[model samples]
Target: MKKFLIIAVMALSLGAYAQVDPTFEKEGDKVKATYFHANGEKSQEGYFLNEKLEGEWKMFNEKGEKIAMGNYENGVRTGTWLFWEGDVKSEVSFDNNRIASVSKAGKKDPVVSNK
Candidate 1:
């Protein structure tokens, strides 16, 4: 009976530790990151913050397409966000409490401009 109780306690302890927490792993420990799921699929992914995402986060679609990747400013997206698709990339700059600009660099700058 004592052995059985000890085994049960050990199992419970391990289970608790396996749960995601801010202390999930050390700074350099090799461990898989945590993620958020939507519609039965992994959609929003981010690093842990007290077991939650505190800084930046990335969201994706079911087809493995990136939808949005931006800062989670203390667990909430607060700054400009960048999005990408196939061969396109764009950034929505935020400044003075407004969108400063949307810069899209479609191609590399020419070494020399045509007159």
Candidate 2:
């Protein structure tokens, strides 16, 4: 009986960690999306244009800490992206979805032009 109870508890715990499907809302021509972690915490939010990722996107970890932020132009990564891990912050530049360069800084760094 104890073994059966333990198995049931484990199943419940696994179910609790199952990720929820992302939600989408249509706003004019853009579709706003919100994705959540298995813990029911928001993991990311962004917009889609013509079924393609577009506009500003922000991501957070399961602990609800901002992990990355950047922009996608017509599904292609563009502009500057910022990532955080521990005490280190990384700046990544992208052009047409290709990484142009990356740098580390203590504070929010300015956007690096691909030119």
Candidate 3:
């Protein structure tokens, strides 16, 4: 039973991943790419230079809600990025595709308490 459950979960996850396969179209010097969710909603859209991610990018959840927005240069993430999680918002900064810093602002912050 455990093996069957594991296999079922794996298959479902893989199916979800496969559903968001990106599609690319050449636009001048850059290739614009757009990914779609399993429900046929836009997941993310951006531009690529020389086959590497470049310029601004926006990401959306399966429900078609914007979740993240950022910029990339030659496949390296740069500048500030904003992410939304429920009522919480996070700001992430990246340099050369590496996370530089992160800040969260919301009504609540999760913390484990031991009494």
Candidate 4:
């Protein structure tokens, strides 16, 4: 039963990932995209084509401010991901076609725990 449950979960996850837009266009190329999220208000919206993200995508905050932007390949975060608060830019970094390094601006601030 446990093994069956694991397979079921994997299948469902893969299904959603495979559920991409079949009619999406990319100017000259025959790219596609699937809306992983709805309304594009909260959470985050994802686009996929050729089973990869081939255009500019945005992930906004609850206040409707863009927090991340840039190119995306497949399901992994690749290229530059610029973070901002409305017009107040925050952090930005480059990704090596895979989610790895994440560099912030300047010095790292100290953390305070309220134990």
Candidate 5:
């Protein structure tokens, strides 16, 4: 019974991964890609250049709410990114795909851009 349960769990995991397929469309020199959750809601949308992540990317939660937005250059994260959680928002700056700094603000607080 333990082995059977393990197999069943593995099968379900594979099914979940399969459901998160991304759709791509050509956009001039870049390709716009949108990845969906298992429930068919958009999980993230962004652009690709030469099969690498490029340009702006926006991430959404399961409820289709925007959770994060950022930019990438040559598959590496660049510039500032915004992440929302409840009544708080975080601004993170990246340098060479590493977090350079981060600041949090309340809903009524003014957010300063690092970029």
Candidate 6:
């Protein structure tokens, strides 16, 4: 009986670590996917083409605050991406999925162009 009780407890505990599946919706040639946090808040959202990541994607914290925004093409990161943390904001540019340039600015600072 004790062994059965321990096994049951372990099985229930494993369920807590399980990942929630993302929801997908069809949109023309692309599919929009919205992934969720364990708490049911939106974690990230984006579009996929031919099962590969495509177009703009946005990520958010558990509280639903946008933390990062970027674009992907053919499953590869492309174009400019922005990240926000507290009062600071970072801009990153990509070329062929490689970092091309990066710049940062603060709430009280001037907007710096990517270098």
TM-scores, each model vs. reference: 0.45, 0.84, 0.72, 0.41, 0.77, 0.78
lDDT of 3 by residue, 1-115 (tens): 9999999999999887775577999999999999998878999999999878899999999899999999998798999999999898999999878899999998574587675
Number of residue pairs clashing in candidate 3, backbone atoms closer than 3 angstroms, sequence gap of 3 or more or interchain: 0
What residue pairs clash in candidate 1, if any at all? 22-51, 49-52, 72-76
Question: Model 4 over residues 1-115: C-alpha lDDT tens digits?
Answer: 9999999999988776553332354544535442433333443455566665656677666565567777765555666677765445544445666555565564444697677
The 10-residue segment with the lowest total lDDT in model 5: 106-115
RMSD of 6: 6.3
RMSD of each: 12.2, 7.4, 8.0, 10.0, 7.1, 6.3
Q: In order, how many clashes per candidate?
A: 3, 0, 0, 0, 0, 0
Candidates 1 and 6, the one with greater TM-score: 6
lDDT of 1 by residue, 5-108 (tens): 99999998877555333223435422225453433445666665554445566777767678778765434445788887656778876554367778775646
What order do candidates take by TM-score, descending? 2, 6, 5, 3, 1, 4
Q: How accurate locally is residue 21 in candidate 1, as Cα lDDT from 0 to 100?
A: 33
lDDT score of residue 86 within candidate 1: 57
- lDDT for each residue of candidate 5 in 1-115, tens digit (9 for 90 to 100): 9999999999999887777678989989999999998888999999999888999999999899999999999999999999999889999999999999999998884578676
Local accuracy by lDDT, each model: 0.62, 0.94, 0.91, 0.58, 0.93, 0.94
For model 6, how does the per-residue alpha-carbon lDDT over 1-115 read when each residue is reduced to its tens digit?
9999999999988877668899999999999999998767899999999999999999999899999999999999998999999899999999999999999998885578676
- Which of the predicted structures, 1 or 3, would earn the higher lDDT when compared with the native? 3
Task: Point out the worst 10-residue segment of candidate 2 by lDDT.
Answer: 106-115
Q: For model 3, what is the error of residue 27's alpha carbon versus the real structure, in angstroms, after optimal superposition?
A: 1.5
Highest lDDT: give the candidate number: 6
lDDT for model 4 comes to: 0.58
